[model samples]
Target: MIQMDLEQRQSSRFVRPFQVTNHEDETFSAAFEGADVNLTGLGFFIDDPDLFLPQQRLSLRIKNEQTDEVYCLEGVEVIHLRPDDSGKYLCGCHISHVTSNQLLAHHRLVMTDAETALVSMETSKLSEFNFMEDGSELSTDESDFQEASMALNLAVSQSESNQQEVARFVQSVESIFASTQSSDMKLQDLKEEFEDFKQYLGQMNESTIAFATLAKLLAHTPAEPQDKLAWKTLISDFETRFLSEEQQVAYDFMHQGLDADEALEIAQEYLKK
Candidate 1:
């Protein structure tokens, strides 16, 4: 006969259905119904009792049904297994090593269940008190239940506050991303405008160089008075087509008494504006 040891619990057990996947291949890996869990121990029904043995350590991934959160319980050793009336084994297990965060999550779950139980008890007592003919004062148990309910409400409020903080943080990140994206677009537009300005400057430089080359050639080459007159007319037409009003003024200054350097300076000053 397989001896079943009595369960020793340090914390109150809460009925919490969860999917349990066994890390080892020897036992069944499936979701067990009618599972109860505390901070350090778990009890659930299994189809085969013989598959599990006492002191057999197993790693388990437990996913909570209500919260949809998964918890890892390592060094989970089987303590006992007893045959139930429904032809299934009630396997009891103890968690040897549980991290602080994991313990806290389990604690919260247990607290939530305790709160629910207190509410149910309060409802039942209230109904009984209502029907009673005697106008009795509130019992000590009822007062205690109310106090516990208040604590649970406080915990729930804290949880809500934490959620609000997280939401605010996410909103802040989104705002920063939007601002950065806007800056990038502005920078791209500025770059394109700068390129267009550079192209305009390049075309002006090319036109200036062509005009200077033609003027130098006309000054050095021998020509008749008619040829010189025709050349001057061509130059005037070129100035009218390619040069701005400011540039034309500089050219007239150069033809008059002003030196070439002084006329060039005047043209540069006008172009700067």
Candidate 2:
């Protein structure tokens, strides 16, 4: 209960229905045909077959349920996401290029059918990334970055066949990023540490390696010019490295029926190790 606000006047509305398709891999697909609330853009409890990390951006196809009009929203950034007691994941997203306030009237309402679809979809038919389909200037670097995030999310979820190794790798990457963000560490020492571990992830496959790279990309929450360009280059590097590797891990883990606690434990053991 984060104080849901329905009177947001600065953005889009109408409880628009949506379809989230994978931009690169067709493995991941989802939709939202739910209520529209004005919580600074929109929020949906996306029934993602795969878990999405914080700050993930993807192409979102939003439609007015009644009118059947589709609005393609590219680079829809996922601001926040968490799960409830029923093993469902909720994603609060901000749709870009959707600034117009289309709906004139506002009221408290809920799209139970759409919400239910989002909350209870089969995980078997989803992946973690989506890109722009309309051929808009979707950057190569951005797509690479998203691909990396997808890999990390999939590696930790039930869909990853080799969950132990993926979790271990993700934990290490998060630990590495955490070190870089530490205030107590000397700048020179941190640089040296970064240089030492820089190629460490590069040697691994794209998805596992992205665990560190995406952290590196998202390290700048509010994105600066230089850092933005720098991160994009690095994200491209992540894809290149992934393509170079043999990728020993199989890609058959989504909706595999593994216990959530077990998967989470392997991925959360970085600090303890």
Candidate 3:
């Protein structure tokens, strides 16, 4: 459970809800506390829960308690819904209209640190309980929890740092590609740079390995002549220069459309030579 202090401005006595009318129609309407307000979800919520009857529309009204202001939000989509033990349906809503001031007010309330900590603790307890049997040891040392938390923090920090490095590398490659004039040379340079970047990524965190692979592939696979040239030039200075003839042959065979097995065979042959 996340606890957040409700902003006074956003605290409403009631809220007016609106439903989608036409399957193709992008907008809908509903009555509010004697006034109607347009609403939109800003693309945040996507799922429509009621499966929204083909062409049928629904509306909801919510009132703000503090200001006694009533907002009629239209074109609301039911992103999520759950039925309680009492058979009351709770729904998560997204507004399709952007002009609703009530929607803006709702976002102002931010979660507090104490609330966040409680939620974290509850989640950890629940996870641990789910893994244990009835008689299993349930208590964990505070030190262990602290250590685990610190490790998670360190991992997140390392991931962010690696992302920043990759971003910098991509920017440099883009710059080079933009400045270069030769197409073939640019392609070669881009490939080399991508290979070097991949190697560097391998030496870093395993969590980011797939990301690095994707970035390298994207950096090298430009369909446009200008893009290819730009990438080639951008990567020229960063291109991984083969340290040995075997590595160079392997790189060449891979570029030549050789299968992985064939590339490996060529590399072995080059090494033997």
Candidate 1 lDDT tens digits, 122-227 = 3221111111112212223343344333323333433444456556555655555556467777567556655665675565554454344333323322244443
Task: State which candidate, 1 or 3, has the greater TM-score.
Answer: 1
Q: In candidate 2, what are the lDDT values of residues 145-223, reduced to their tens digit?
A: 4544444564455235445545665676566566745564545555665565556444434444444334333332224
TM-score per model over all chains: 0.37, 0.28, 0.26
| Model 2 misplaced regions, further than 4 Å | 1-29, 32-36, 48-50, 98-273
User: Is candidate 1 or 2 superior in TM-score?
Assistant: 1
Local distance difference test values of all predictions, in order: 0.52, 0.41, 0.37
Question: What TM-score should be assigned to candidate 1?
Answer: 0.37
Q: Residue 162 CA error for candidate 3 (Å)? A: 1.4
lDDT agreement of model 3 with the native: 0.37
Order the numbered candidates by TM-score, best leading.
Answer: 1, 2, 3
Per-residue alpha-carbon lDDT of candidate 3 for residues 105-152, written as tens digits (9 for 90 to 100) = 322111113443233223221111111122222222343343233334
Ranking by lDDT: 1, 2, 3
